[model samples]
Target: MNSAFLFGLLGWLDLFGIAVFATSGALAAARKGQTLVTFAFFALVTGVGGGTVRDLLIGAPVFWVQDSRVPILCLAIALIIWVTPVRIWRAGAVDWFDAMGLAAYSVFGAAKAMQLGIDPVPAAIMGIITACVGGVIRDLLAGEPSIIIRPELYVTAGALSAFSFVALMQTGMDGIVAAAIAFAAGFALRALAIVKGLALPVYRGAAEDE
Candidate 1:
């Protein structure tokens, strides 16, 4: 595949992640019967929070600030959610959308870090950050429990995508192929966790009173 075309494809994946994450954020506000302004605020913060942190940590320019389109897209999504009927969101819709964002963002984040000459380990870490920080911010702002404190697989899924992308790229596989496989793996894991209630084994060390 052409490098420019590959870059464009990756760009689309980034936008896909942003849109879903933003939707989840908007849905959060909607659930609370919030105003359009609040919807937009939640959407913008959750949409760019992760990417902003990633860029800052990687010493790259903040993406949304550099590209007006990012914030505009977020606002547009918020407006859509604001105007749409609550029935559209349905039960568990937010989790599904979040799963999609987590997968795509994880792969895109790792890929971007690799492109920027970051080492594989840190690049993978950037992927996790990209996939998670936004939701963390959203939950905190909404007064919900942090995803990190939950038992179901969430960050683990993101790590699968990020580390898988890095490992695949290290083997000289095509970026597109690597990204697809990684994204699928992450999403599948999260989906299973959502559907089957799969979770990592929690600590069973010493007794609290010990």
Candidate 2:
């Protein structure tokens, strides 16, 4: 795909991912009995943290700052979650939304890196950052353990997807096609991990733990 089309597609996908992240973050804040202000803070961080980091590292303008739409989108999602009946909010849908956000951000980050002429390794690393950092920030704000520190295969899924995209790009596949494949791979892996309790190996030794 052309660069313009790729950028536009990435923008839309990223926005949807941000909405998912914001909604999930809002739910977490609600679970903590936080006020609406807290919910908005969590939502904004979860929605924009990863993209901000990615843009800074790549020397692009911070995304949400340039486009007012991103923050507006996040706020709208937060409002929706905040105003929804508590019973509906408690129905365990947030986890699914979080997974989708992870998949979307992973694809967007890897694609952006490739567009910026970065090497594949860094591109893949960017993808992982994009997928996880927002959640990390939200968890910190909510006083929960960050997902990256968990034994679960969260970051690994992002890495796998990003590397797959990079590899496909190296072989001359179109950016859009590669992004779609990467998103599918990451989402599938994450869903399977959640269902089957898959986790990355932790060190059995004390020294390793230290």
Candidate 3:
């Protein structure tokens, strides 16, 4: 893939991920009956938290600080959610939006890392971090159980997306093709987990009292 084109694509994907993640965060605040200030705070933090960490780890500029549009976008999303009727949002809206963000961010993170000359395994790990860390922070701030702590397919879905994208890129596939497939696979897995209550197998060690 052309480096410029790949970076540009990643930029757009980053925005998409940020938008959905912000929405999820705003929804979290709305669910808790928080004020607009709280909603904006949650949106901004959740939207940029993972990306900020990823950039710092990879020696890149923190994205939201450099991009004026990022904070504005997050605040705008929070305002929209605040004014909208809670009834308009479907049940589990936060999870659905998080799922969308997770898939897109995972691909973007892996691609960006590889473009910056990172190795494949580390790039995939970066992808998972980008996808999941934001939601984890949001859950903690909201006083909810972190999804990563559950048996759900949250991080597993992100791993599938990131690893699949990296694997396809390794084969010289088009970036768009790899991204689409990876995002779809990840989102589908997460959606199935939401709809079907699917879970990873739990560890079954000997009882502590035994």
Candidate 4:
């Protein structure tokens, strides 16, 4: 794939991931009966927090700061939620969006890190950060238990996506093809978690320690 075209596709995927996450944030604010301003705040932070961290760690400009449209996209999501009735928000809609974001952002982040000359293992870690940190920020700000701690396969799903992409790329697969397979792998895991309550088993302390 053309390098420029690959970056363009990755950028679009990142934006789509941001939109899904931002909408989830806005919906969270709506659930809490927060003001529209709060919705915007939550949306922006939740949409960009992970990528911001990723960029900072990589010594790159913060993504939302560099792109004028990123914050605007966050604001748009908040506005959409503000104008819509909660009744219109279907059950499990947020989970579906989250799953999509988890898949898309993981692959996008890994790809970008690889482009920036990051080592493959760390690049995959960056992908997980891009996929989950925003949601963590949202959860903390909203005073909810962080989803990261939940006994679900959330981060594992993201890791699988990121790892899949990196592994495929190492095998000389096309970036776009690798990304598609990675995203599907992650989203499938999350879908099973949501639909079937699949989760990682909680660790139990040693019997003597307990």
- After TM-score superposition, the amount by which residue 178's alpha carbon in candidate 2 deviates from its true location, in angstroms, is 1.6
The window of 10 residues in a row where model 3 has the poorest summed lDDT is: 201-210
Best by TM-score: 3
Query: Model 4, clash count?
Result: 0
TM-score of each: 0.96, 0.93, 0.97, 0.96
Q: Please list the residue runs of candidate 4 whose C-alpha ends up more than 4 Å from where it truly belongs after superposition.
A: 206-208
Give lDDT tens digits, candidate 4, residues 112-200: 88888899999999999999999999989999889888877899999999999999999998787888999999999999988888898
Tens digit of per-residue lDDT, candidate 2, span 25-91: 8888888888888888889999999989999999988989999998888887778778878887545
lDDT of 2 at 178: 78
**In candidate 3, what are the lDDT values of residues 1-210, reduced to their tens digit?**
677658677788999999999999999999999999999999999999889989999999888899999999999999999999899999799999999999999999998888889999999999999999999999999999998987778999999999999999899888888899999999999999988988988766766547
Worst 10 residues of 2 by lDDT: 88-97
Best by lDDT: 3
Pull out the clashing pairs in model 3: none
- Where is model 2 more than 4 Å wrong at Cα? 207-210
Clashing pairs in 2: none
Per-model C-alpha lDDT, please?
0.92, 0.84, 0.93, 0.91
lDDT value for candidate 3?
A: 0.93
The positional error of residue 177 in candidate 4, measured at the CA in angstroms, is 0.8
